[model samples]
Target: MTRRPAPRPHPANRPPARAIASAIALSLALGAPCAQAGESPATYLARIAAIDDAGPELDAVIVTAPSAQSAPHHPGAPLDGLSVLIKDNIETADMPTTAGSLALAGNATGRDAPLVANLRRAGAVILGKTNLSEWANFRGERSSSGWSGVGGQTKNPYATDRSPCGSSSGSGAAVAAGLAWAAIGTETDGSITCPASVNGIVGFKPTVGLVSRHFIVPISASQDTAGPMATSVTDAARLLTAMAGPDPADPATAEAGAHAIDFTRGLATASLKGLRIGVLRRQSGTMPGVTALLDRALADMARAGAVIVDVDYTRDPAMGRDEGIVLHYEFREGINAYLASLPGHPAVRSLEDLIAFNKAHAKDEMRFYGQEDFLEAQGSTYTAAYRAARANSYRLAGPEGIDALLARDHLDVLVAPTAGPAWTIDPVNGDNFPGIGAGSLAAIAGYPHLTVPMGAIEGLPIGLSFMAGKWQDERVLKIGAAYERARTATLAVPRFKPWSPAPD
Candidate 1:
């Protein structure tokens, strides 16, 4: 666990005269953009570098490649001239995939992940790599969400003092802050939806096997998949279309070619009409403010002509416990295999090596929290215990969880509050995340989950989630697009204020 930085004044509360002057100067340096004008790659990269690295010090972007300035852009490509940021865990031929760890500083493989290759073919410029929770937040129980040994902490742009959520923290923050038009984020659980919700952006976690996972740093093959994070549902849909396809390297994606469709094709303001949406009231937690917002969202859906059905998510309470057991086993095996496959000799070649490295460099790597999870994972074996855990988790979370709820309610999709507003970042005690997140069911089931900005609580954004049975990625996106269009006027842009107490 890296040490937390000292607290700083909120930009709105009080700013030193010199700091204000410096911000003004930087803003002037970044000239205004023409409406709907296409940006040159060089100009796009420079703007990101200036805003993310310099002006607000968002710490979202880890590195930008020079080749981005010369990256090909075909006029007819769907994503032509669009700038996209890759989460650091995803391999890039040009940049090191550090996964926010000092141990992987030499981990550049010079081979793009299949997903990256698809994005390039669509003419999207890879702006840079964004920081993430070190080891994708799998290192410790008390670990901070967005703090990484290699890239430091990534602060939420909405409220600088709040947590951005993990492990796709930078991807969410970057897109919300306008550092890039969109970004790629990988999730095993709450990684994509949590951050995207708190950051007031759109995140689409596609159905497992819908997108290739080749060349991505692994967490669990059972749950991991990379998806798009964008400021709008339509943009996310478009990016998903470009990145999704069948890949020979990943057999899980064997059915992807048949299911892949232009996700943006069916998006319409009336898409939600005539749809049966199950309202998951039990999952939104005890926060009154969040519940109020959720109620309003439900009313909005009713007005949109969606038939709302109340549904309860009743599942084995041990599902989470079993999921953890499966992850520990998979993390040890997947990480070791991924490390062994790196192009060249790397310092941390296995899970055991990584644990030893952390012990050897405790001052830098474990300054605030120990790698308890890593140590626990090392003791796991892929035997009967692992297989049992996986089977139990899937059965509980899938057939007995989301599937049961949807089937009983006769629902096309289930809706719930993605999460509460961002929590204050605390280094000493780690993340103080509030509210219940509707990520676990979709994550464990390897199904599609989409989160869209709902509204805000004291300037911090809340999100509404849409989830469906596996392979319903298009349905989720279309519905989310409809909701987004209906609520666009109420959505508040981030002001980057310092954290303050929520109103009672």
Candidate 2:
């Protein structure tokens, strides 16, 4: 037995360098698991915690509570051993759902949102809560994207000083930085996709009703939905599959069970072949770097057997004004309802209560921007004016917006740049997001939108968006997966570098 300690494994017996390298390359190419075998949830949390607030100082996480950490393994469950970060707005029994504001500091409901329960049932470890734009970026006009009173500013991992883009800023940054395998981010407008794009990750804003929004802090009931942000389309699709299902608490999800599909099923590189993809070229002009990347993406898709059709899709100018009206009406209605539904009395009981709390904590909450949007929303009423605005906004963004173009061109999906490169995080002037975004149409229409990493500009990542009609989530994910496969080689990984001024 003493002699049976066995000859200690030696470097001489190890596989050749070339052989080991080839094995790794093959594994990555085949999309095999890259994490070490039997990696513990604690191991992952430790790794992410090191970089989250200390190394790059991304400020992407609001809280990493002890209770959120998972124990050991659950091999039989769907997401066995996977770790997931929940956006701070999504209710978690163990952690506070701050929505990146000081007003809701101790608003721990001691209950999981329906979606979070689903994730837990599938064996996912709720790792922590990620920072978000305060009140999901609906608190003010010209507000900084990733700044929050509770979590400070979530920096873009690609460049420390660049905006991570909200309101899912931390969700996106955390996934992009490998903090967790995936994250849950809710989008009312561009909250999910914009941050996913700039952070160079796959963000899927599912059809509005496909995922239950029962416990999420609301921006708009008409458009808010929690989505999956992951490093790969396949992972995003998998997360979507687990999260999509009907919930009794949310009437909107009544049809979700019927519409939900195994999104990762039958995914192949040939998925793009013969598919008619209409290119949304109008929004590609503002950034030449982004335009160039988009042009290359179009060509690549064409070469991959996609029917490239140039479609002119112009958003109605009045849509924005109408959307503002609807959001304001809903924000006040939804936030009040959410506060009332909480089990314990929270610090801020209503939208007006929140406004006062911010006023009281001006030094922290109002350092950069005031709650103008909240003020405007508080004044809005759910009257005929609100109903009319909602109907008009939906009509313009749907039937007259994304729908018309797809129908005209007989296209399967519409493609556009998700957003421009990450902008500098300017607390004084706020977000200077210069490029066009395709999220508005799909967002207001309550349709599915998926953003996959396209490439980068000056080290800042950009994303290509694929969208389709309502409940066409599977189609969007499939097409996105195909494009991601083709462009995998060119996709850049994040380098936590600090931002620098442009050369003279």
Candidate 3:
């Protein structure tokens, strides 16, 4: 199970600096504004070139989009001159929408997901697609987070050999590495927040349906939503403002149009003053270094006039079981529906077809882990068991969980450690998640969840998550913006280190 990576500059020797500085410095050196349709700024191209020169081309980016660059850019647009990459699962008219699976190798339908269209209207350049966890990490039980059959494994910008966490691993890593100004990532659970946390970037998973999921590869319709992974909270708001709207094709988003607002407006005066926050002490886990950082962040918030109250929310065995059932039933239905809707794929129209595809191509697709999850989803049915599990799970996670806690404690949102620092990327044994994550709480409830760079553990970044009940998207983001401002000085920038603990 041993492997080797090409050598690169070690982070320990390099000074900790903002990853975006390389791009800005290069742009200034070469003169600014490399403007043209389907072209990136002069600095970004140079920055990408630098990475290419250092080692590999198969990092985060999979397919590059030149045709979409010709899309009309309205003057005085919200995101003019900005370049953004979307997860490969989200359909783009000009790019193949592969969820890092060989089954959808050449999916091109000449249509953009509504959220992607919203981005184009906002004048953002469609950079391309980023690699993700194969089938968004829903294919196998012990699957590696960043490795994919199509795009291979994405590395953490801070540590090349460390896990980036998925299935939005590429989007998070690309933004942190300055491959793009920002990127779009879809989350069914921690797909956005986990990768964003470990990559040392800001990741926001808005309430389900706030950003349209139309034309994106499906997981669970109740939980899937597209959001932004960016360098800062303000940048996230800018992207969210453009991405949120009602899409006629997706019924889930019928009420989303009404909630759409200038998300940036909430950031200008962002503050922690008079805010009541609940610290999920039970959920934050017990990593000594991580707890110290969380303590510091909470102290900073308190010093800024915020009230911190400790809350104990114990886990229930039933929630995980129900979620499994819910996802099992949903994955079968969702994947079948998505595949059937594709322009042409006669052989890959259902989950059963996908299982067959992997078996036929086992040498490539199942080189690391077998698709136990695909098999489970294939066997699952939308029976009374599924409905009961879905309802019970929702109740446990939403009204009886986060909502109940918030109401009982008179708090605005709950805070916890996003996850432990990135584990070493090991395909042989799969991911060794060091600690627990509260992403499932918000994810199951279809509420808003955001992770901000709190601090680092031996140069590995950790995130502080802020979660609130459903429809509180702006509120959740506003609170995160305030925290980001308070803790900006301590945030860790990626140093691009190689694997540590020695590969044995």
Q: Which candidate gets the maximum lDDT versus the true structure?
A: 1
In candidate 1, clashing pairs total: 1
Q: What is the lDDT of residue 142 in candidate 1?
A: 78
Off by over 4 Å in 1: 1-39, 501-504
Task: Provide the overall lDDT of each model, using Cα atoms, as 2-decimal numbers.
Answer: 0.83, 0.82, 0.82
lDDT by residue for model 1 (332-399), tens: 98999999999888898899899999889899999989898898899997579888988999988888
List RMSD in Å for every model shown.
4.5, 8.1, 5.7
- Candidate 2: clashing pairs of residues: none
Give the candidates in order of lDDT, highest first.
Answer: 1, 3, 2
TM-score for all models, in order of appearance: 0.92, 0.91, 0.91
Model 3 RMSD in Å is 5.7
| Per-residue C-alpha lDDT of model 3 across residues 256-282, encoded as one tens digit per residue | 988889999969688899999999998
Candidate that scores best on TM-score: 1
Greater-TM-score candidate between 1 and 3: 1
Clash count per candidate: 1, 0, 0
lDDT: worst 10-residue window of model 3 = 29-38
List model 2 lDDT by residue over 138-250, tens digit each.
98878999888888888887788899999999999877776777889999999999999998888999999999998899989899999998878888888898899999999
